[model samples]
Target: MKRCILEGTRIWQGDPEAKDTYVDFKGSFRTEGTGRVFLRISADSNYTVWVNGQVAGFSGCADYPDFRRFDRIELTKFCREENELRITVWHYGIQTQTYLSADGFLLFDIYEGTNLLLKSDRHILSRINPFYRNGYCKSISPQLGCSFFYDATKSETPYQESVEQGPGLAHWREQKPLRLKAPVKAKITPSDKGYFIDLGKETVGFFFLEADSPEEQLLTVFYSERLIGGKVNGRPGWLDFSLEYKAKKGENRYLNTFRRIAGRYLFIECPKGLNIRYAGVCPTDYPLVETHRKFADPLVQKIYDTSVYTLRCCLHEHYEDCPGREQALYAMDSRNQMLCGYFAFRGSAYQRSNLVLISKGLRPDGLLSICFPAGMDYPIPFFSLVYVMQVYEYLSYTKDQSLLPIVRGTLDTIMKTFRSRIEENGLIASFEYPFWNFYEWTDLSHNASQIGRTKEDKTPKQYDLSLNCMYIYVADMYDKMTGEHTETEGMKKAIKEHFFLADKGIYRIDTLHDRYSQLSNSLALLAGLGDRELAKNILTDPDMIPVSLSMTTFLYDGLLKTDSGYRDFILENIKTKYKKMLDAGTTTFWENEDSILDSKAVESLCHGWSALPAYYFHILEA
Candidate 1:
């Protein structure tokens, strides 16, 4: 058996007057057998995992009282017995006041055939690959250590940098640029009452308590890299100070300026024997272990545990970025519990209203993060469906008939705004604004063309399969709920005759174009428009299968609806393509397979749609 343990490790030491206080430990591991692995990790705050050198999973939170995040990795193909794992961990904020006894260990069970051979300590032991601290730490899940670049420069370019307040800092400026000197000296002074740090920024990073208490400790940076300083105004993280600098910029001028201003930028600890420990240096590649621990029962438990998270995620209650009740619910949980309200607002009021109700049950500004794709600006046929679906979901999930007044009022606002924009053809026209106005059609990369507004307009009149089908589904669902079918039947008939090219065995945006999209196929079947048998057959077809299997939502749904053969096909495909997806190293599913886009480029990483698999698992079992 292999194992590594660290006990009574203090990551934070609170003193009334201290500059620094916090500690963190991290490690990495790889598996050596094609079996299952169970990981049990407990820490002060939370941890994240990267498989095959990409972020694969993460867990933990003080917000949700019952949130105990443990990971069980299935080392199949993408992750070989010799795979790589990376873990980064953040310690609890000093204000947490939880008894500190930090521990990190790994136990791996090696197997040969049905019999188990050995289980190594989470850390790898080898002659050439010595059991040093650095490399193994790189391969572990939930790593510790974040990057800090103030005046870090290479090749004469100053990185573009900004210092802004975190969750709080109403008084602080947004993306405030700060000039600094090289080797910035960060020193702290600790007193019995609290602590203080003179970092030489316009804002002094310090804390003071009125009397003796752990929460009174000053200079409490939960993670030093993220906070120059912050306040605890009622909520846990009220005030915030952070430095965000781009390393890719020319000359790194901003970093150089900050470095030049500060004399010494190295990690500093204050007097009174500060509770601080060097989490680890920045930009340093840590060591890693390849083998993993396995357990038959643990794997089952993991599935059940993940299902609970999926439910929480579907309600947009857990993850990185949950949406509001009034927004569209994407199929996944992008937000952690903080915004555990809703998903994407591509187009669906049922999804949005469910998400918004979930949010209202939690926070006041729950719906702010709910983004309506091409709302107000880019008008598209599918976008309005988002509004309709959210209303239905909100009504159903909450079962609150009293809110009918609010719901009706919001619907009126939507109808009044969009009704005027509908073209003579009864289809909502694409926004005719600058810079690719329509969200769905315009943003797609497959040689996108415009959808004209007027009947006489010249742009391709190709109607979208997914959009039209969703229109039918939402319109029908809405009419049943509200006693007004309106023009729903007309919409459904038009879609069936025009886009439903029967002879081709696949629906098309335009029968003449013969375009076949994975989205069109999935939505067509899901909306109950296409022939079930033909749709099932085409889904199993090798060429279409790859695209359909790219996202787990489709696969999970297909597997539940189809027989053993179809399920096996998707299972094998997922197993085969798992590594390629993780090797791409994305925290969330991407718009495409290639995920190495510029970080500065605006893209959705925690998009709700991609997380549908998490939700699909529950629906499958149900």
Candidate 2:
């Protein structure tokens, strides 16, 4: 099938590489009694289409330039004879964990059938948006990108002809469109400087507000995943989850789909006599049709329900590590999310799209980047191996052999990358520089000092237990998938000789470092290096260094492989840990057991990878 012609010239004003800028395009199109019209659009960072000032759609899928995607939205009902079309595109030129630096441009086309009636050209007027203070770009986090200062009192610059680049190139994208869902009606109580509004539970997405003020006032909006002293903990250390909006005299209306926020509470600071019409977040939620799952035990059912909600909050443009902190997709974080998603959502489309997106993350050394569509180089090597397992699981669950071809080269390159790294010692060496050899948030990897170590930190020699075992595990999966041996048996033997501590009956992190972690031992068992009796012994020992919530699946996997009877043990273990969170009145599980994420204020109360019980429910229960 012939794809849509790259007809519309990519157009923008100002330095195409301006760090953080907002540009608006204004044009009018005559419908002329159209049979069926569609708004075909793509942008550098993000865009929102307003047909006569009504939000038609928002967001461009987080992507890279070589592997770009375009959205085709049907506008037959919204379009009229004299229609006004306005699109605002937020261009983020700086490199973040979630975005790659690219020239700011947009390709917009209104087409009826194949013939394009209107296209973005020099005629479509555009200019740097004045309402948003462009140079005052404050970051929410490295992953989520920019937060803006929107001024309703500011004047606008007259739109000019947009400078033309060449034609655009992209394939039509397929995903559920984001919809504005009403949150629970908030209860607003007056505070020292602002009013605290709670949506009653954890929520994800953008903020929208309509209010009437007695006079012109400047209001500061603060939001976060948790509260401090019964108020929103907006600013955590240096990170800012706060934005300022200047309101005019009478009624000020604002709904920014561009600046996204994820939290249950909003702190709006306003003057006296400011009447709030309806001020709360309208979640720009990705559609989740939940499977009606039931559990005989009430606590187990509650755990399953919250786990599903956690998964939903983290799933937006792509699978995020945490919607509050980093709305970026890491391979390992998403592997757990996908495992749970296969059960909760009961469909493979979103997971498949995300897997394909992950496949597009190409690096110079044939290793995938840390996050999808991110331009940074610091990657956790274990996550790349986990990605191999994710693709295999997708095929296993769906019995779909077709995706192998699309990701065949990627899978092959990842294997070759790891295979070449196997040293003369006959074991995979831990990466030293420019890479994070993180397996989990464990002391063995020494991640407790820094969640991800800096370039200066040196990892152990060639006997990293989790690193080698991960390679062996994924290599076996690849070999099984292709029926070609990766000779993992030899590597497994080398791992056993080097890392196994006979006295302790557990595997050490490396030969050089005398450290043992639940994850390293779990990986050893799963990779087929240890005996079943040893697995039973190591996993049951309370003295063993425990893994974090994200690594629970490995422990669970290793235990199940030991014997299916461990299912009861697994359930009880899950209940014991998760029950504490439930008892603490957590609606969504914490990023860590301590509710400590990066800093105290930035605690992600609703994290995605912590939602793995959703997967366990489907697997163990079924």
Give the candidate number with the greatest TM-score: 2
**lDDT digits (tens) for residues 1-622 of candidate 2:** 1245557878998888887888999998887774798888888989999887678889854888876778877778787778999998989888888988898899978877776778889999999999988867688887777888888888867988889987877766667777767645788887767688888788777777788878878888888777677667788776788888888888888888886678888899886546887777887778878897999999899999999988888887788888876788999889989988888886788888888889989687888898988866577788889889999999998887888888988899999999998887788777766776677665666444434567677655556888888888888799878777797777877887887888888887777766688888888888887767777767677777888887989888987887788888888888888999888777898787777335567657888999988888778893
lDDT by residue (434-476, candidate 1, tens digit) is 2122323112312234422343445543445555555555665
Which candidate ranks first by lDDT, i.e. highest? 2
- Name the runs in model 2 displaced over 4 angstroms: 1-4, 32-34, 271-273, 446-462, 596-599
Model 1 residue 310 lDDT score: 26
User: Where is model 1 more than 4 Å wrong at Cα?
Assistant: 1-381, 412-431, 434-461, 510-512, 540-608
Kindly give the stretch of ten consecutive residues in candidate 1 with the minimal lDDT sum: 255-264
